[model samples]
Target: ILIDGALQNLDFSSGSVEFHNLVIERELNQKVMGGTEDEIYIFYMRFRRGIRVGIRLSKKILLIQLEIDSGFRNGTLGLLGTFNDNQNDEFVLPNGTVFISGASQTDQNLHLYGLHWRTQEISSLFKYDGTQSWSSINNLTFVPLFFNPNLTAFIPNATIRRYAQDICYGEGLNDPTPEQRKPCYFDFSVTFDADIANDTEKTLKTIDTAKKTL
Candidate 1:
């Protein structure tokens, strides 16, 4: 957490804290987490002139909500991509190249675009404890994007992709829709668990509710 313009390492296991009018709250809501998220914390901050940010943490989820005035439109770029109305221009590289060999939102294009924006530990702005290093992900369920791209061990296969599509677009889900398949595929690729897509569904709904209320 960054407080008073200083970078501070925060531990939310103890209790909630109020600093400089920012609220760091801890709440237990089993229903919302599908009775699996043991730890849940919500941090909300409001900036002057209608720039607000909300961060919600669950067991295996980190959701972010942003509210910015249209005045700053098309003025930002990062993992979330451009904030402009043109969605086709997203996945742009640092060199401002939107397409290399071809255009469109293909897997190859997205991989290159996301890889360009990947941050290194040395260039990170936040503090780190160094307890869990990126190199120690040998036994993790999913490999981080920092891993070597040449290895296909962590990449999704045709069968896994089919399963993710079925679970995300399947009927009787949490408002399952065709458009939601992208996020669901991401979660599925990470965990290789079809049920993981449910978390993405719930998170989207949570974001929508926050937009309406705050």
Candidate 2:
């Protein structure tokens, strides 16, 4: 069976069909200004097998990629993971791909979105690791440029911000008293760009202002 572009709920009885492979893809584009367009594509896949009637599981490969194009500059980013089962009972794949034992289930949920901005460019990418909820991984911003009198089209400075969030839940500690468990959240942000025309400061300030208002 094939599912496309949405979430699906499925249940199977024992000795039903077996899951072979799973694939996911997302593509997005953003037009900044003056006919310059930035495009992003992300692809991921999981390969698994069942062993000993749910006593052991095996995974082959996991991969992800990001491609960006903005008329003048183009770049690509990619990630790959391969699992080697030596003696461990369970293992978690790099890049947040999880492998579980003793559970016989499969699910697929995918989402895609596109946005256009005239004054500034904005783009975001998110993924759910199955261990926790979904969260954004990459965010980009593009700044406008103007031709200087030196007969050169000076590229205005811009900042590319990346963030990752993780949540951990604990049941309770040995306090001997009644207590509630809450999820611990971890979030961090990093900015990357070169300083040109003082545009980096301006763009960073704009982001800060927007966050304060929200």
Candidate 3:
């Protein structure tokens, strides 16, 4: 990852290190600026003015949460959407197409919103193995999500909603709220993997506790 201007190799390292402006602050007490917890790596950055970013990375997920000052309100665009304190115009496309508010987020509309914002991965910040290229995987008429309505047209006998709900809400985890468990439902429904949702749940909990420190 690019911290300030230098590149960092955080793939295997876990200890505290300070090299120039790059600082890896381990999770200790409540003053953690950023560090690693288990296999998850947390990185926090506070730029000039009032722009803050918290990044949590694991093998299965990458969460980048942005915290900006109110001065830049309505001054940004793209996948973050129009931040004018109005939820109605959240999904504005590059060509000025908007999935207007009050329209239920169906599988089609959600795919439209997601696919519109994907850019060509010309370059990457980190090194990895056996990664698929955008062109190799991104087909013109392909969608990664299957639990929603679009999949039913092809598979008439598909039944995933009840199992997904049971794993997400009925697994006896009393800590995460309904909002927090929403990711688990979607993840389980998409991949049909019960263990993959742990990444989302852990990332959310860590963000909740470390938000104040960031």
Give all TM-scores, in the order shown. Answer: 0.52, 0.18, 0.56
Lowest summed lDDT over 10 consecutive residues: which window, candidate 2? 178-187
- Evaluated against the true structure, the overall lDDT of model 2 is 0.25
Worst lDDT run of 10 residues, candidate 1, spans: 146-155
Write the residue-wise lDDT of candidate 1 on 101-167 in tens digits.
3445656556656666766666655444446544453343433443222223433465554565556
In terms of TM-score, which candidate is stronger, 1 or 2?
Answer: 1
lDDT tens per residue, model 3, 7-73: 6766425645555544444442232112334444466665556676777754455668888889889
Sorting all predicted structures by TM-score, with the top scorer first, yields 3, 1, 2
For this target, which candidate reaches the highest lDDT against the unseen true structure? 1
- Which portions of model 1 show Cα errors greater than 4 Å? 1-40, 100-103, 130-214
Q: How are the candidates ranked when ordered by lDDT, highest leading?
A: 1, 3, 2
For residues 22-90, what per-residue lDDT tens digits would candidate 2 score against the true structure? 323232434232233434222223233221111111111122333222331311111111233322222
TM-score-better candidate, 2 vs 3: 3
Q: Is candidate 1 or candidate 2 better by lDDT?
A: 1
